[model samples]
Target: MTLTALFNKSIIVSGISFLLYFSSFLSPGNATSNNARLTSKDRVTTASPAVLVFSKTNGYRHKSIEAGKAAFTKMAADKNFTVEFTEDSTQFNTENLKRFKAVVFLNTTGNVLGDQEQAAFEKFIQAGGGYVGIHSATDCEYNWEWYGKLAGAYFLNHPGPKNVLNGKFYVVDKDHPTTKGMPAEFERSDEFYSFKNINPDINVLIKIDEKSYAGGKNGDNHPMSWYHDYDGGRAFYTAMGHTDESFVEPLFLNHVYAGLQYAIGK
Candidate 1:
């Protein structure tokens, strides 16, 4: 062959060899491409997803809000998720809500969001966002029918702050991710709320045994926690985190984590 032809042949050979080497270097047995050794089913995400915890209240605010914040913060660290805590109603815009996988309403009450803010949040949920409501989250946005439906219930009455009940919490749906491993029934002390306008579509996860506590208006099969899909989004609510101690309880934290995880599409 001519010198030029020979040189072109060498270039082709070198190119083929380099490709072979590169392919071998990135093989499934290798670790360079991150989790390369694991199959698709075995692989897991390491990047943390984000969630927003909004605790604004236009009416009665729970003093345990701080504790709830701390609990979620701790959960993020242990569960491989990121959390942003804010009490600012102005943060309910599209730009602010976009980054979150879920928005957690922690003991929020009354009409927390303004007209524009409410519209923005509605858009978020419509765009497949998620919501996790803690304790008195059901107490808010009485005038906003869309929000009331999203929350699944509205606060009616509780036996007052002074009448904390060590109520028997009946596990209604143990199959749900939120209450998957929880006991059949557990006693917890907190202000049990009787809800109004309870959305008929919600999947009840736990019910409070009304007989275990006084002033339990919704006598038989009264729901205390539930979840539902609403307006193209996922929602979970638990009326259990009423006391500061609730945040520290392992069972309670796990329950909340599972719900939040479910909302985030885990």
Candidate 2:
């Protein structure tokens, strides 16, 4: 063959060799090599962080549950988190629970989860998962002791004739992420839940000014929102979101977002 023809063949041979070597670097399970310049589309896939919102109520159901779900779903869009809403206790299983970073008991009341399901939930928390109890969530699972303390408190009574009342909230720990950006004090019209056997270890984020409203039961120390580290996990609870209008309130939405962030350790 001619010298120029031989040189051309050699060039083609070198190009093929180079491509073969490069293909090995791009092979499955080997994309992390320094030589691999994989684009995002070529990278291994992962599920986005997700939260499960449970709103099951064997007792009285909240009229605001749908509003609460809508609010969270909107917030999740902006926060880049995924949210799944379910009233079915069957979703409380080892496999399904493992997929979530946080489980929110949104206005959940009465005995929502059965014994086996509750066990699964406990294990989920103990495995470093998060829990967020909203409004009537405090009224759930009265027979489950761990759930009571994990929820920060149990629902006892509220000021009523009517359970919903107008009250002023005091931001007890503004430094807490959940209470940060919150006003030092603000008035809200919702069900101000009275809790029984509140866990003192909980870091109170906001408290209600009993003197500002009637049926003051907890004296001056009634907590409206709180968070704490519990059983290898985190727990956040807020006695807010009782009314549909409350979910639309900017402050209340922010409060719920902050609580979720805290629970998820974001």
Candidate 3:
């Protein structure tokens, strides 16, 4: 071949090799593969909504950390939310709180937070951050007056020594997104908590009929789930989701998904 022709061929070959290398770098097996160039919409979708999950206690009741984690993983796939799970109160710092759009207390109990963490959480909520409490969250931080107030109630007690039998729940707020699709009266098996000093001002979403269980603190008016605006921030709580079975329930999962969406301002 002529020298000029050979040079042109070499240039083409070099270009082809470069393209192949570049393509390989962008392939799925690469560490940065999924980190592919994101469009504006993609960036928005993948942007973390910032959620902090506090699972500081197992309480005296059955602990289901794995169950909570599984549910959270499914929720995080939404691409609009990022979740961090921790049992350490030190993780509740001002900077950490500021990073998150919402904080979730997942099946926690007892005084799991110190004064600093408690203050940081209060400031976070007052500054318009969102809060979500699941299951035994009400059983936590009993001494902190603000915690109970924000939760809209404190765990006074529970009905049914075991939480397997079907029980009736009354839907108090049919219009709320979390309880929207749920029926007026539904039966489900799960540990239902009764709260003390349940702020009547908060919007009650679901309640339990006393006749459905052996012993309940709030009688027939037991509020099992609720949502409200507290201190300029949104808050949601559910007495459901005590077991692995509860998390898999379609209706219960839908309720949780709606609550998480609302909490993240979706």
Candidate 4:
């Protein structure tokens, strides 16, 4: 064959091959479902990395749970992550927890997890998973010594009348990423919690000025937000999400987001 003839023949053969490959998808036998076709060597799964938000409350449930969920969902979307909100403690298993990089206790109070679930979560943390606790998370699992340390404190009491709001947020560790971008001194209206058994090892990100509020039990250096590398994983806790309105506040929401990022090791 002449050089041009050979080249034309090759093109014809390539066209036939391309047509056949394209037609295969149009056939009924090549139907794609359940991500079967998407799970190939060159393709990654569509599932985004996610956080597991557990809001199960066995004690006084916070009404801001819904607001917390909404804010977390937005924050996850901003980072291209997903949020899985669950009230069922059964999801706290080795298999289920493996899907998430971190777990967020959004105002979860009292004994929410069973013995098995607790063990699974501990294993998850030991395996380098993460935890983010908000508001009443400190009020949870008082009998569980490890969890108390993870949450960094146990809730003692809030100010009198249960409405002594907008205490001065004094940045203690301003250089920490969790406190970065936050002002050195700003007032936020939250049902600020005084703490007991405050973990000495925790890196306090921010504290509340006791003199700025009514009930000041924790005294001068009352930590409101903190983070630490606990066990083999990361943990972040903030005691400021007590009201639904706090979720809408830009500073408070970003503070929580920063803590979330820190906890998830992002």
Query: In model 4, what lDDT does residue 122 have?
Result: 96
Candidate 2 lDDT: 0.89
Each prediction's total of clashing residue pairs, residues at least 3 apart in sequence or on different chains, is: 0, 0, 0, 1
In Å, residue 210's CA in model 1 sits off its true spot by 0.8
- Measured against the true structure, the TM-scores of the candidates, in listed sequence, are 0.83, 0.85, 0.81, 0.84
TM-score of 4: 0.84
Ranked by lDDT, top first: 1, 2, 4, 3
In the predicted model 4, the residue pairs found to clash are: 166-189
lDDT of 4 by residue, 1-266 (tens): 89999999999999999999998887777766424565663243345568899999998988899988888888877877778999999999999999998999999988999999999999999999999999999999999999998889899988777664877888998787777788899997889888999889999889989888788798788899899999999999999889999898888888888887787777
Residue-level lDDT of model 2, residues 1-266, one tens digit each, is 99999999999999999999999877875866543544454443334679999999999988999999999899889877889999999999999999999999999988989899999999999999999999999998989999998998898888889877888989999887777788899888998888898998999989999998888678889998899999999999998888999889988888888888888878
Model 3 C-alpha lDDT per residue in residues 88-198, reported as the tens digit of each score: 889888988898888888888788998998899999998989899998888888889888888889887775557455688899889889987788998988876767877
- Model 3, runs deviating above 4 Å: 1-46
Report the lDDT of model 3 for residue 93: 85
The best candidate by TM-score is 2
lDDT of 2 at 185: 90
